[model samples]
Every structure is written in structure tokens, then in C-alpha cells.
Target: MNTDESNNKGNIICGRCAYDANPRGATHCQKCGTPLVIASVPNSDPSPASDSTLLVGGISVVATVLFFAIGGYFFWQQVRVASTPSNLNNSADNISSDIRLYNSMKEVPKVPEGTFNYGGAVVFAPLRNSLHKAINQVYPKFGLRFTEPKYNNPGQNTGITMLLDGELSFAQSSKPLEDTHYSKAKERGFSLQQVAIGIDGFLLFTHPDVSIPGLAVEQVKDIFKGKITNWNQVGGPDLAITAFAFNPKFGSSLNILLGPELDQLSPKVQFMRDYTDGVRKVSSIRGALGIGSTGAILGQKSIRPLAIAHGNSKSYVPPFTDDGKQVNATALRDGTYPLTRRLFIVIRRDGTIDEAAGVAYTNLLLSQEGQQYIEKAGFVPIRN
Candidate 1:
């Protein structure tokens, strides 16, 4: 064998025959015709270059994974913070403010810059005195004003009539709006809307000296209807029951208490000029009973309120508390008292200054501060 030929770079060797010196690109050995195998170049190691490439690729993959993991952790933290109770509460408050659509006296909407005449039932006197003064103090630049009826007694019916006649910008009422009131406002080229702002109830009252158990609602109704004329019929002395009530024509108490039966009152039921007059008469006359505003009757020592049961049910709820001095606001608010009713603010929807004034007044009354005033006035606030 020639050593120089075997040492050539392009030489092929026959591994089966153990022969060298095969020509370049030969597939078999020439001497024995055995299959040839190509030999690799001498001293050419690739481990350093291949290992460096692998390391670089591994580092790139790890860096990419870490970057994504860090970004994901920060994103999760942000989501957790956004769902916290304080943030959720802020979102809920924003939604509530958007839905309320009304403002309190402190944040009152734009109102007409002039005096506005307003009046209502005598039961609202205390509320008006407190609420109106606060309104004036909060909105002095708005020039809002309130006044009573100039020509007659302030009452539910009177205030509504005056509002239809354009004598008042708004009115307060202890009774629900009637069909006749709607018709009258329609005849005057406008519609009347009543917004409930508080809860009230009618109180069955008598002289402090009258001693008797509580009466059923039906028995009280029968007494007022002249069906039961004797106090003995309702577990009292054998004295004749003289039922006195306010005139339904002027006051809304009978209308609210008796509903459509306002005209069914017995001829024996004497009509008083006002609640004060009714209280005075009942306190002075023996065996005399009358119905008046719970708000007005509370804290009156001369007269006593009776516990009233619903129909024949034995659960008698008194208009006053157990001590008989303060009003049973809980019962009235929960409708446990059989004589509960709502008080409203009547507004004219004629797109005039009166409407703006009335809406502003209603918004103020429906505010939290205004409801506090209502509670202070001895009436149950409609809002929590």
C-alpha cells in the first residue's frame, strides 16, 4: 500500500476488506470490490460551537417564559385590586347617583330665581317650618320661598284647589290624589302629579277621662256610621257614643279614613272646623270620640288615643307607643297600624315656572336631609 495515497483527504476506505487507497467518490474497493465508507476530516471537533448555540437558545426560552410569568402576575394583581370591596362600593355609588335623578337641598338643581307660593294640609305645618327654613339656608341665592294660603285655611283640599287655580306653585297633602283633582287639573290645561314623601295615620282619640278597652276597626266604623250608638256596645259604660269628625269637604281626614264611604257617615256625626276644634270638643264632651291626624294628636295630654284592631282580629295596634306619648312610628311605617296613609307633594306639570319650582321643592323634600326633617316633624319618613 502507498502511504501518500492513503493519507489523501478525499480517500475512501473499504471497511469490510480492511483496504485503503480507494479513489475519491468511489463506492467500493478496487482490489476486492467491497463496499466503501467515507472517512471524516481529522481533528475537526464541533462540540464547542454546538454547545454555545444550545446554551443561547435555552437562555432565550427561559427569559421569554419569565417575562410572560411576570406580566401575568402583575395583571392578576390589578384584577384583584379592581374587585376589592372599596372599589366595588365606589362603582355602586356611581350607579346609584346616576339612577336617583334628584338632588338634595345641598346639591339642589337649578330653580327659578324668585319667590314661589306653596301651601298644604295643616298636618304639614311642622314639616314645612323646619324643611323650608333649611332650604332657605342652603339655597339663599335661589330665591325660593314658601307661604300659606292668603284667603282661607290651609288644608289638603284647599291647597289642591289653589294649585289648580294658579294660586300656588306647589302644595302638600296628607291624602292621595283623587280623580276629581286630576279632572280639575286637566280642565286647567295641565296634569297634577303627587310624590309621596312621608307616612301618616289617622288616630282615634277621645277624652282622657273615657275609660274603655280597645275597639275593633269595624266597631269604630260602625260608631261613626251611627250603627253602634252606645259605648256599651264596645265594652264601655252605658253612655251614648257621639262621634265627631272633620268636615270632609275641607279636610281630607274623613276622605282618607272612610274612602268612598265619606258620604255614608251617619247624620249624627258632627263635623268640626279643624283638628284643633275636634280635639277640644272631644276632650270636653263625655263619651265623645273623634279621628284626627296622628302627627297632630301626638303629645296632646287632654285627649287620649285608642288602640285599634283590624276588623275582628285581636291584634290591636295603638297609634301611640306603649307609653302613649310618642307616635308608634314603627307600626305606622310597617303598616301594622290599620290607618296608615301616605303624604304627598302635589306639583303642576304645565312646563311653567311653577313646574320647575314644584319639581325643585319635591326633590328637596325627597332628599335624605328632607326626610330627616319629616321625622323631626313627628311623621314617618318614606325614605330609609
Candidate 2:
């Protein structure tokens, strides 16, 4: 090889073919014809930030922290509100200022500040009188005032009608709402609900001057039907028996208590406007016999209840067992009492009780203290 040729064949080697050295300034491997690349050091210079860019980054971090803090605060507030107990029905020890003390810890139902009217079976007048005093004693701040209860010259039927007609805030019923009345209520877009307050029994009573003890169930049926015109037929005086009762339109309990026997009663039987009137009539008439609630008759010294016979039984029982001192609560509850009836406080089904005086009154009657009033009113309490 010549000197210039040997100088040209330097130490460079073709990476692709691993061939012998190539000449200087060559861009590719000569033997394989492959392109070549040379490695170089990377630049370390960074891009500079502007003033606006720094401001935006700082604001983003602050906003993220603030959003998390605000979300946490709202979640805590919701938990606090949810954890707080309702003030309306809290226990006595935890009562709020807005709630008033009742017979116990149970908050007295707060009613609207207004006078409410009530009417119903005249027989329940004693119960009303008793409740009027008890409610006032327990919850004076309830703000509901009641006018004198009106007998309305009838019984449950009149009271229920008046209640549905919006003339009364509540009605005290001797019986449950009839199917006809229920349908009538449905037509008006509401329904009736009842709270049984107490139990009452129909009393076959007469003026104290009469000497007769009691009558059998069959005898009473016959007397009211005009089948037996004279008292002598039932082992009484020669005087004619004068039957007095509530008119058929007044929803008399006798109709329900007497059952099939009421159907046998004469249509012409003398009817009174109210139980008090019936009682008054019997007091004056010598041979008059009338029926009313045992609670009502027990109050009148002039009236006396008769011993009534059970169906087909040879034995007769008095209205009271303890020598006429106390009403037979057990007999009445057990259906052994022939003329037993239930008394109820009626309210509208659409939550009207929340704002009405009737709810307070019912609550009072159902309370442990309220049952005493039932006994004071001469009726059997549904609860002890």
C-alpha cells in the first residue's frame, strides 16, 4: 500500500458490517451502505416562567384547599342537624322550653289558639264533664278553649253529622262510624278515625219510687213492643207500662244494645229529645221506664237501675255487683253485661288531629292519670 492510502485507512469501523476502517469524513458505512448517527451530550437549560404563570399556580393550590374545607364544613353541619333530637317528643328530662309538662314527660299536644266545639252521645256528657276538668289541670297552656258541650237533642248520629258538616271539631260516639257514614266521609275526601276512651253500659232504669226490682230481657222487649201493655204482666203494679227512649233518628244506643228486640219495639213508642229528657220523663211518670247510660243514671239520685236477665239464663244480675256501689267493669268488658257499649273520640283521618283540641283531649283520656277521670265519670276505663 502507498503512504497516502495507508493514512486514509484510519481506525474508524463500520458499525453495521463490522468491516475494516473507512476513510475520514464518511457519512455511512462504505461496505454495507448503511446510514450512520453520532451521539452528542443533552442540553440542561429549563424554560423560564412568567409572572402570570406563577400567580395562576398559587391560586389553583389555594382554591383546591378551600374547596375541600368548605365541603367538609357542610358535611359536618348536616350531621349535627341530623344528630339533634326532635324537640316535639323528647323525654321529660330533655324537654325543650317550647314544650310544656303534662301528666308525665310526654309533651302535651299543642292545639291552635281557638275555641273548639264538640258534640256527641248525650250519655257521654259525664265523661266530657270529667275530661273538661282533667285536661285543664294537666295542660293549661294548650291554648284550646271548649264551649259547653251540646247534647243537640239526639245521640251519636247527630254528633257525627255535625262533625262531618264542619260544625263540630270532634264528636264523642257511643258506637263506631257506620258504613254509610264512612262512605259519606269518603265522598267528601276524608276519613274518620276513632280513639276508644272508655266503656259504658245501657241501664234499664226507672224512678226511685217504683217498687219493681228488674225485668227480664224478654219482658223489656215485650214492653217496648207494646206486647205487654201493663206492668202487672211483669209482676209489677196494675199501672200501664210507659216506655220512653230516644227517637229512631237520634242514633240511640238502645237500638244497638237491644239488637233484634229493638226491631220488635213499637214505632209509636214515646221518644225523648235527649237522655236527660228521658230521665226527666221517667222521674215524673209513675210507671215510666227509660234507658240511658249507667254512668248517667248513677249520677241521678232519682233513678234506679233494674236487674236484667242474661239471654235464656234463669239468673238475673244487677247493673253493679258490689251492692250497686261500683259499676261492673269486668262484666261489661267480658260481654256478660247485656247493654255494654264503647265510647270513642273521633278525628279526621287527614292528620287534622295535629292542630285540633281533640288530640289533646284524647291523649289526656288515654294517659295513666286520665283513666281516673273515666271512673269519676261513672264509665269503665278502656285502659287501667
Candidate 3:
């Protein structure tokens, strides 16, 4: 066997013997009489196996390029659509529509055409002067007029009494109707209904000379309940605490401020005729303290509102802002303010023109336009 023979050129090699001297076209080895295998040439035409592999690889490469190209094209289309002026305008229009939806006031119900007498809590005087006047200007046919009790001062209790005595078509109240009101109304062969349309809060205020920053809710209750008699008891100067409040018979402001246990007010507690009277009295006395509506006492120069803390919490929230120029409406709406209540419209549900007028007025106050006026009049709108 020729073991050292080189088959560098295109020649055959024996499969069974170490022979490489077979001719290019031979099928058998000359030295061993065994089968011969042909060697492949470089740069010649490819075989079927090589062709099949190349075909599959080519298809894969083409498919990958096409996939990337299609994806890129769709992404470019999306970006183009998003940045177009028409789409931008559509987005702006959607935002405007959303705002309009929030402040829409298109469906205010109608009232009967006649002069109606309505009056109630002096706390609602601002709303009556502003929102009521605006309502008249907007709907001139609804002739809503504010009236007061001729014999006594106008207040929540007086207004409800007048309503029960057929002196008023409707009344505005700062507090909810109690069971006693329902009982009285039933005795009169008519029932009273109240619709809450605004949010209000009670604020404890004192003379400008008093330097106490705030008080705990329990401390306030105790002061009004005659348990705490000296200003020094609740972190103030050593002065006799003289508390002033509206008579509970005239209005429920005191009830809402001091809770239901108001039977034992301080011996020094003086009942004022109204909030204005309380303000005047408190401003004159050295150690005078008073509680009134946040809307009423917000901007008073003679007296200043005090911050209040709830339970054992030390964080005190003032009813006014830091500058003392505006009410802290966020706190009132979120219930962070310790003393908050609702303002209501009291209407007799006796199926008369008074009922129609009352329902219509309540609807107006709860409507979007009316709520705007309510907020303008320094009360939190019940709607928004």
C-alpha cells in the first residue's frame, strides 16, 4: 500500500486501504481493490445538501429583515398620527368637554310665577343677598323676596315658626330639622322637609386681645359647659372666661357648636341676640369668647377665629388660612375641621304654591349655577 502518496489534486482515495493514487474518474482503488471516494473541489458548483442549507438560511435572514421593517413602519405611523394637528385639536376638545361636564348647569327646574316670601337664619343673609338676587335677575318671573319676622329677630327658629304659622313660604336653616320640628309640623297638619345645599362650619373666636392659638374639642365643650371657667385653664392669660353665644331658642348655632349637652352653660355665659350681637359683646369684653359660623366670622376684625384640635390629636386646623384672609375650604370639605354642618332649605310639603316655590328654590340652590353663587357667598357648594 502506498501510504505516503498525497491526493492534493482532484483525485480518488481508497476507502479500505491507504492509497491516494486512484484516477479522478475511478470507482475502485488499484492497490486494494476497495471502493474509492471522490474529494470535493473549492469554488466549484455546490452540492444538493449545501444548496438546501443555504436556501433555509436565506429565507430566515429575509424573514427577520421583513419583520423589523414592518414593525418600524407601524411605529412610524403611530407617531405620525399622534403628532398631527387634527389629533391635537381632538385632544383639546375632549379636555374642554370634560370641564363643561363638571360645571354643566343646563337643567335647572322651573318655578311658578309669583312673589314668594322666604327668610331664615341670618347666617344665610349673604346667600340671600347674592344668590337670591342673582336668581331673580336670571329668572325674573320667579319673584323671590326675602322677609323677616316683624316682632322678633329673624333666625332659624323664628323662620321655622313663621313657616308653621303660615307667615313664610319657605325658610333657610343652618342646622338640620330636629324631631321637635317634625312633631310641630305634624300637629299643624303639614310636614316640613329640608334640603341641604351647602356646607358650613362653626368657628370659635375671641377678642383680638386674647392670645390663645387653639383649643381641643373637649376643652371647648368644657368651657361652654361651665367646667372650665378661667382662660388660664386652656393655655391663656389668668382672666375670667366670659363666653358669649346666641340663644339656643333663637337658633341652633349654639347646639351645633357645643353639642347636645348645652343644658349647663357657664354661669358667665351670656346669650346674645344674634351673631352680630355676639361679635359686639365679645369685642368689648376683655376675656370674651364666642362661637359663630365660619362664613360669618371669617373676615371679622373685632374678633379672630381659633384653631381647633380633635380628641387627643395635637394638630390644630384653623378655620382661616395662614394670612387670615380666606376660609380654609379644603379642611371643611374633607372633614378635617372639627365643627362642620350643612345648610338647608326648609320647605312645607303641603302641595300648595308654597311647595312649588320651595321645591323650585331648593333645586336652583343645588343646581350648578346656584352652587357657583353659593361658593361666591362664602359657603362650600354641596354640588362640587
Please, what are the lDDT tens digits per residue for candidate 2 over residues 144-226?
Answer: 33323355565788888987776677777888666577556656655555666678888888766667767777777777788
Model 1 per-residue lDDT tens digits across residues 224-332: 8789998887778877887887667667877766777767789989987667788889999888998887887778888878888888776889888758667789889
State the lDDT at 167 in candidate 2.
68
Clashing pairs in 1: none
- Please give the ranking of all candidate structures by lDDT, highest first, separated by commas: 3, 1, 2
Could you estimate the TM-score for every candidate? Answer: 0.69, 0.67, 0.69
lDDT of the structure predicted as candidate 1:
0.68
Predicted structure 2: clash tally: 0
Off by over 4 Å in 2: 1-107, 141-152, 260-263, 321-323, 353-355
Give the Cα lDDT of each candidate.
0.68, 0.61, 0.69
Residue pairs clashing in model 3 are none
lDDT of 2: 0.61
Tell me how far candidate 2 lies from the true structure as C-alpha RMSD in angstroms: 31.3
- What's model 3's overall lDDT? 0.69
Cα-based lDDT at residue 78, candidate 3: 42
